[model samples]
Target chain A: MFEYPALFAVAAVVREGSFERAAHVLNITPSAVSQRIRLLEERIGAVLIVRGQPCTPTEEGRKICRHVERVAMLEQELRAVMPSLGGEEALESRITLPIATNADSLATWFLDAAMGAAKRQGFLLDLSVEDQDHTATGLRRGEVLAAVTTLEKPIPGCDSTPLGSLRYRATASPEFLERYFADGVNARTLAQAPGIVFGKKDTLQYQWVRRAVGHDVAFPTHWLPSTHGYVEVSLGGMGWGMNPALLVGSLLEKGALVELIPGLCVDVPLFWQARRLSSALLDELSGAVVKAARASLLWTGAGR
Target chain B: MFEYPALFAVAAVVREGSFERAAHVLNITPSAVSQRIRLLEERIGAVLIVRGQPCTPTEEGRKICRHVERVAMLEQELRAVMPSLGGEEALESRITLPIATNADSLATWFLDAAMGAAKRQGFLLDLSVEDQDHTATGLRRGEVLAAVTTLEKPIPGCDSTPLGSLRYRATASPEFLERYFADGVNARTLAQAPGIVFGKKDTLQYQWVRRAVGHDVAFPTHWLPSTHGYVEVSLGGMGWGMNPALLVGSLLEKGALVELIPGLCVDVPLFWQARRLSSALLDELSGAVVKAARASLLWTGAGR
Candidate 1:
């Protein structure tokens, strides 16, 4: 059994970390907040908060709060769609698509296909981004209608369409490359070179080294987990490591960083996959993706 | 965007179909039930019941109710595991195995594997079943820790352990076979035979008939969606069709069902697959499964 305050109220409290501040932020009386939390706990039979100083969640409270967060998120997305739902004529045919993608894509060019599709046909968008590697998790959970995955196989009940390759080059600032690989970048020399990595768990650099050397090689690698920070570290000449071409374009153009091995890039073919729900929304989204892939990476065998 | 009553409340209403009935069931006043429904609607922003002779769901209401049902199911499962969670001398690791199987296997033998593993180590079960063809969907979604699948190919980011072949024989009551195939049981003759099917969406019979003959053949089939009922219909001499050997052992012994095609049974190889999470729980579960498979089926391939 679990309960929490209205999601917005709970979220406000969590964000502010105090009932007084959360009440102020939400423009509600502190007594009201206290009463709501008390009522919620009574109904769910789970104490949600530890009342002294900054509040913390009981185990059950954490679960209930998580539920609230999910509902809040769904509500935010639903709000974006509710406006269009006003007209009952289109209501029957309307279906919303929930998709999960990477943050980089959301900021970059991922929305182009969706935008084009929206221009022609109206649909609601529910997008959640974790990370490229973990996108499949979202697809598996039924949280998303479709996903962009590093995984090649389709989730059951869903079909996969290859988008295009995402190629990354082993690159570094000219200063770093010159300082470390002045002897012209051989396998032994490269193995000893200091490197910047995407994250502790990110094995892109290690994989690149193996592919280049045709064997397993361990190196003293520095972890800069942030996508933006990763390129910044490489650009600052901290070390040599693989970077997405799209992200390091400015550095490449400025001649600040040089590719250690030209055409020795890794191409991870992207895919758009979704469950085989007999949903017209899915079909429309699929059509939009196919069309966009033709204009973007779909033709370069990125979608093989 | 979508909200219904808390799972227990929804269960009560679904059980009784009215505020008064639900109030009586829960030993609460009808006013309390009305208040709960009103609050639930405001929180979920979905109209769960139409103000009519009987309650009905708006689309959003149906979705919320579905979520309530899912939450209810998970709660029941969690309660079952709660007792063991309190007993902790050694640090026991929990791993989730996601498997996709038909409901019949899920309700039957799958639980046996969990029971077998319970003595050796502590485990958490995350059971999800789609149709045999859709079990792989769980793998794609990562909802399951492992799966029993019909697909030959392994999903990405996971490995597959072949459990063995699951053979479906064309079986029916002796009386049924006698009536349907009075002339003889051959491809063409069976095409003209009446058949019992799992459901309208089930195409097993259709596939069997098409494979048997050089051309596509249609059989006059009646729908019996439940697995037990499908077998029952065939056993009652109402029709002839396929039935799993595991469920028909006693009937076969009693000569109630005779196999129409001897040694021509269709065998779909099953697999146990999981995400490549490096955890002790998965390792133990995998060990139990491999041991079970050794004792159970005809597996040749290796997977870890």
Candidate 2:
């Protein structure tokens, strides 16, 4: 069997981005850290790291880090099942699992899933928030083991599970509508009004406009790039934009935001895509995420 | 001369990601929008777009869009110089220029540059906040017209100019340093103490540790992924981490943060990398950015 200690050392170095820092985190001398990494690299017959200002892992190193992360999760599950076999290291060890997800989910319900998983598996999660359409790119590059994405399809060696949909409605503060869109929702008028967007890649507002007006229209946009900020900006009368139904529940009731198009809604279906790791901890993490997604998202029988 | 109206329509459709939206923005019919795109495509003898849920520009289409944006900017600059020649459309037209930049610059001083350029050039800015080290990838991919990056090396066919450097220091609340490092800054103790990090790709903490301790060491980190949140977390004594000198002026004066390693500072050099656009407005934008960067960042004479 591969040396678990050295493998964990490699994983730590990759995560921490420095040999000294990784050594410190592992509570080993820098020399010991170097020796462990060298041992692993020698055994694997590959240069694992490109030592620079802040060292970066090689492609081979990334593969090993991903494998070690999975193994650590499996070990955690194994220890959970067979507590009698647990040693001092297993009792207090916390593996780092880097994950990629969209900004909207992270702002909504994904944190609950992550906290639940952390509590249950005793692993620290490193979440990298990107756009929903692109999170799977991280999974493909082995930068992240799992991602919550819009793609219903699976990667080469991954599993994709349906995780409900986030339903959004075009909304604006009443004052914003009265000021900018006084002429009503038409092609000419949409061009004059501003809309808040999450990022350059956000197409929710455009898609809503296409559906609502029966034609695509170009308009000015305020790129907030934050879920919370986007909502606030829209509600603060800076712009009119799509807000998730789950998040706008209270605001809708309080009449803080007026739905511009009552029947027009955009449904963004989400999926939990993960590298097909045999670890029960991954299964547990997926379970927690699915549970949380269901709790907040509109249930539309998976694979949308 | 070469159907500026049709070309602008194509660019708008690409930006808005829909034909209907482009049509609305242009104050034209959807059929007219489609016709303009078809006319442009037919003239160029190429497929300009891949019509999907969110229509994307094809390779040739991207080139045309980029050219049109540049031409629009040039026209705006021209109108500025010769206001008597400006048409009604020229008076109100706003070109969109997408740029990639690091989060630190965005939070610190880049917005002022963007606002200055926008106010002068009549352009809407789409800023994609990424890490400085990787912003060049966006430049290479033609995803952005320009990027503020750490790489002094110019991307092929792009202009790279020195934009000064951000100075960072290892800092934390005085109470935190005392509590965590009562014995001293050692690997064993650092592993147990939490540190706030901006993102997974952020290596400021690791770099600081390497410089201060003179060895690579691993440590626990809390990835906040927000410039503002990371600072607040550090100030609240949640964790110790590197804070930019420009950002922590007030905090340093108030003794909210104590330098963990005195005289240990990391200066990350930055470059403004941009496609060699022939537009006068792009030149103006770069001048504004360089001026702003000089005002904030420590100048290292270029080519570092």
The candidate maximizing DockQ is 2
TM-score of chain A of 2: 0.88
TM-score (C-alpha, index-matched) for candidate 2: 0.68
**lDDT for each residue of candidate 2 in B1-304, tens digit (9 for 90 to 100):** 6788888888878877678767766778889999988988888899988896468888888887877777777777787779797663621366667888887787677766765676555466666778778888778878788999999888998999998889988888898889898888876677667676876568777788777777755565656676655576577676787888888878988999888867689999999988887777677788899899999999867445
TM-score of chain A of each: 0.64, 0.88
Docking class of 1: incorrect
Cα lDDT tens digits for candidate 1, B1-304: 3433344455445333456545644556778877887787787677766644235455555545545534443443454579564422111112223334564454334545643463244333434435676778756754455677776577998887777765577887786677667777665676556566553234566566556654444344443334554565566565677787676767888898888766556665677776675545566777777677556554555552
lDDT tens per residue, model 2, A1-304: 8787888788877777777767666767879989998988888899988886467789998877888877777766777779787753521366667888887787677866765675555566677888899898889888888999998889888999898889888999899889877888897788777777776568888789888788766677656565665576667676788888887878988999988867689999999998888866677788899899988888968335
**TM-score against native, each model:** 0.37, 0.68
Runs in model 1 deviating more than 4 A are A1-30, A47-107, A111-131, A136-148, A152-162, A271-304, B1-304
